[model samples]
Target chain A: MGETIDLKLHVWRQSGPNAPGRFEDYTHYAKAIPTHASFLEFLDIVNERLILAGIEPIAFDHDCREGICGMCGVVINGRPHGPRKATTTCQLHMRHFRNGEEIWVEPWRAKAFPIVKDLIVDRSAFDRIIQAGGYITARVGSAPDANAILIPKQVAEEAMDAAACIGCGACVAACPNGSASLFVAAKLGHFNSLPQGKPELDRRVLGMVTQHEKEGFGGCSNHYLCEAACPKEISVKWIAKMNRDFIRASLRYAPPVERKEGYG
Target chain B: MASSQVLSFTRTAIGQKALVAVTGIILYGFAFFHALGNLQVFLGREAFNQYAEMLQSMPKLVWATRLVLLVALITHVVLVVRLARRAREAKPAHYRFEERMDPSEGILRRYARQTMLLSGLIILAYIVFHLMHLTVGAVPGLFFVRGMAYENLIYGMRTPWVAGFYLFANLLLGLHLYHGCRALFQTLGLRHPQWDRRSFAMALSITAVIVGTNVIIPIAGLTRLVGGELPEDPQEVLRTGEEKHTVSE
Candidate 1:
């Protein structure tokens, strides 16, 4: 597919969200692209040309050329990066493109994720969810020394598996509902399987879900699309776990009643 | 070490999850019960309407519950916000992300970040409109009537927009619960290799059932697909083996 794909690109051109936003179209000049060139590499060629022409290079989110850092996220032709499995935009190579293709690249379009620039957004809503639904409350010294807790090997591996999320906004960009359950759940699973994260487990789950809802992410439709789009393949299982924790906590919880001490 | 000076590191991937677990459970649990409770409208106006009346009557319980929920909600948001901020802060500039795992990636076991976000957002919108249309009417002394949930339910359904939204949201909820319940089990360390397949299927089916049936109910009412006097038992149709399976994941 390295045929120097002939295509029209509908790129999101917003000076800022408050500023006007428009879709600028450009035709490919047919630069001989390597089939192995990652998608971003292809963009680099375009950016170089724009710079030479004294144009502001297109701004999109990307970091750690490797996929782990979770910096690069964009909707390419309505898909979060070109269609691929367990891969992010940075890892996406050029081979997926055909000789002639009309591609659309846009920043994550969601209410909560307002655009900061061309493709950057104030994705602090994700931060908001983390602040509420994250963490197993532990007093530093209270945690046992590293080896003191012998968690089963499988549990550790699974927890590590959940911990692999890179905080990319692809799920929001790809989700029809713009949900963020996967991101929140991964954080939930990583700590809930261990002893150190137990004391405040109930409180943590309750807090995160509340915050997640406030941020305006859509609900999961059980379509498994988010799992499919996920770069890290973080799993819906953690979310399920989050649900369970909330239920159990609810059953056991007795709302703290603020009394009017002087009179009822 | 002075407790005040101690830098209580608030954000980490592990910590983030603990928060998700707690919050996800509460939200999903509430939704499941709410869906189940709302369907009681078909049990005839008297029974269903009375239920709402009863819940409204307990001001103390309701107040206490709301207070506690507000606090818990605040705490959850605090944790998520801190972690997300740090993650963003750690990256002074935009970075790229890609998936590396292939055949090894478990369907239900991976992709937690995106899924959680999607569900959280959808549920949020649903909650707002839901409370506005359903609960607020009664509390604000708006158009709500005593012992008239059936009439209210039908009237709301008659609006193509409301029915359409309810149907759409329920479907999304189903998709959400499918993996959510299973993920919950895994996070709690309850998954077994031998039964994983069975569990996943079970989880998927439960979400499908809840979302599917709930959507159909609204559509049926709106479209006149199934019309008759109120049924003797509404929740009976929903009785399933999966009720226990819904306990997170």
Candidate 2:
């Protein structure tokens, strides 16, 4: 058995969307957590103790507990997903924390992401931005052979790197201005790099950027805090690319003119 | 259709950023040329006065350039103000126990990036004071005369308070220029990974040159290193229109 370590957790607790939140001390319940356990498991142990004491368990979101779902996240000591760089909250192990350490956990903070309860926030703002133009209209009926469309190796690698963004909203949470530029840029770059996504590049960038502004996200000031906080390690170069594409599209790409079918 | 498209474009965040970048380029260009022009003060009295005379010689061209610069400054300020406001509104609630991650860009770069608006506004105020003191000659307690650019500059900077203000404002301008130069390229989508480091170095060098020359001019004036001796009787000198002594080469 791994050595157990004591910890003090100050987890954010909010009753509802309109409710004011505060950090609730779980020091007593969080004692003797196993070092081998994940951060989520430590939370589970604390919740179990809370339930036995006839108290409401901390309401937090988690699924798969494997980090790929991008569901589990909390601002542990002011970082989006604890201190481990590029690792999600679920993947953060308790061993990273020292004995008698104090942990402060809070939900993602952004106007677009309202706190639902405790550490869970409504990240639907990201979805709406995605829905604006994050996809291509190209109809690929089935999974075609990879060699059929010969994407250059470098382009494929870059696209894959950009595609690694899991839509976790960490970029927004970590951004000083609460800008979603990195996230939007990642989505645009992922599609724009590939030939299949080239046909609608202008539409995708314009529509998504327009929606991003409408959602009340701040503009990118190139502080690159989002790049630092991103779990996937997406680069800010994509933002530069997005800016380029947006300008090119705005200047030259005109929308199709509407035609009257019967009149005139 | 084109007009509506232009209007709608300006309404978007990227469009606003593009406007800021374009204006920033104009203002930066003006600053660079302005700094080089002001360095003529070190060339002694006659040379500096002749430089000023040449500038006034082309009144129409000078006024047109001024008009363009004024419009660019206004556009830059307004768009950035809107951007900053939206940024504040986007993150309405503050984190009770927030800790910013260490940026990959060094601390100085981070400080410069965060204080762009603050430095920019201060620089704007400095510009007005600068014009009033040196150009319009409306500043109180300064010996003023029409067509006396060289005399006006020396008189203005000889005052300790006025020279201090110029130094402070020029330092902030340096901070503003450092971030503005780097960010403008990024905003305009002109940055490339291959030469990103070179670009940052270029920005620093440009900022240093402008700030160094600007700061030097005032310090030179304060120490009497530049400019001819001030005549004891300003009224007599104004009436006679004669130099008290030739500036040492």
User: Which predicted model would earn the best TM-score?
Assistant: 2
| TM-scores of chain A across candidates | 0.87, 0.96
- Residues A117-223 of candidate 2: C-alpha lDDT, one tens digit per residue: 98899988889888888997866699888899999999999999999998888889888788999999999999999999998888788888888888889999888
- TM-score of every candidate relative to the true structure: 0.53, 0.93
Give the CAPRI rating of model 1: incorrect
Separate clash counts for every candidate: 103, 0
The Cα error of candidate 2 at residue B134, in Å, is 0.9
* Sequence-dependent TM-score of model 2: 0.93
DockQ of 2: 0.49
Per-residue alpha-carbon lDDT of candidate 1 for residues B1-249, written as tens digits (9 for 90 to 100)? 111221122232333445555676676555556667767766665677688788878989888867766666666556555555543433232212223323455664455434555655676587677677765654242234334556556656656778888887776666566656765555443555678888778766656656766787778777755334534233432243146347544
